[model samples]
Target: MTQTDWPSKVTARVADALRARRKELGLSAQDVTDACAALGYPIPRTVIANLESGRRASVDVAELLVLAEVLGVPPITMLFPLGTAPTIEVLPGREVSMWDAVAWVTGESREEAMKTPTQTVLNMFREHGILVSVAMLSRELGEEKRREAALARDPEHRAKFLDMVAELDRIHARDIQSLRNWRARMRELEVVPPALPDEFAYLESSETAQ
Candidate 1:
């Protein structure tokens, strides 16, 4: 579909991106014209005017990258977004969607998957905020001894660790309807909020040094 056929946000996002690029690069609209020429795209001032005013929308990824390179920014920042983009921080590794969390855990042995302290940290960030403290996780974990076997390192213990991890992996993998079911069940049972798992908490001082 043409720019004229795209979503309104696409047009607004495009305009905001280009306007920001121009400001950051210290470029006039004419400078974009020169850079576009060097890249063989050659967007004219009037074309830019239309784009910035939302009369047309959408630019190709490669074209966006070429403009970003000429304008001196990352390609994503040119059209999608950067660190502050809407869906970035809530998604692990700054992905575009929540499903990325599932993909990361798929088919992995429970032991390896639980070891992703990063994913757990990201969950905390999503539920709370990026700055959620380790102390919060620590307190919750300390209260759930049965759910969280000791953090051990014997090779034999690793198997047990993985078994515990499998249960957790299942919980986090719940789809929206499953989560809704769980919430309803909890309400019916009048259960308190469950504790966060251990091993999901911060590294011990020893773990941190590594």
Candidate 2:
């Protein structure tokens, strides 16, 4: 497919979120496109490739809905992770960012949501040793950073700061490695879209096909 308009930050975030979900589900571009077709949405594999590569910018509501269905996530979660704290204008005189509303809904401080990892990462960690949530790791990291910044004020806590760092390093080694692998895979997928599979080749007979 021909490239669409230059992508925006929102579209970029959506693309990252979509690619992340697809990888989590072990679904290829062809698998996603076929699922859309089964749902009667008929999303071509090139369209998915373009979207993931940020070559396709805007996504209409129908496409978004079908994509969410295929990926098995709520539609908004596909646009942005739930704890992202994205700002929004609710009404003419009132506005609330996601952080505020979520805090209110959950009866927790905004910091909690900010520190909490997305459900995806939490699930990943659950597959490993303990069910250590992202929030747990984030809290440790956040405290360490905060203490590290104040180290000049109290050099006595330097040892504690180092201890925190070591603890975090030990606890999050797998998560960090997994994140690195995920980013590398994303880079690989950002290359030119894959050629249509044999069954799909007949559907497109042009240089730019979808």
Candidate with maximal TM-score: 2
Clash pairs for candidate 1? none
* Candidate 2 structure quality by residue, lDDT tens digits, 1-210: 112322354566667887998999999999999999999989899989998998987777898889999988877665545676576332233446855544443434354444444443433433332322442465468566656856646666766676666667665665545444443443354422233335334323543452
- C-alpha lDDT values of all predictions: 0.53, 0.61
Candidate 1 local lDDT, 52-115, one digit each (tens) = 7777656666666666777776654444454444343322234443233233433222445465
Give me the candidate number with maximum lDDT: 2
As for candidate 2, its clashing pairs are: none
lDDT of 2 at 117: 41
TM-score of 2: 0.40
Global CA lDDT computed for model 1: 0.53
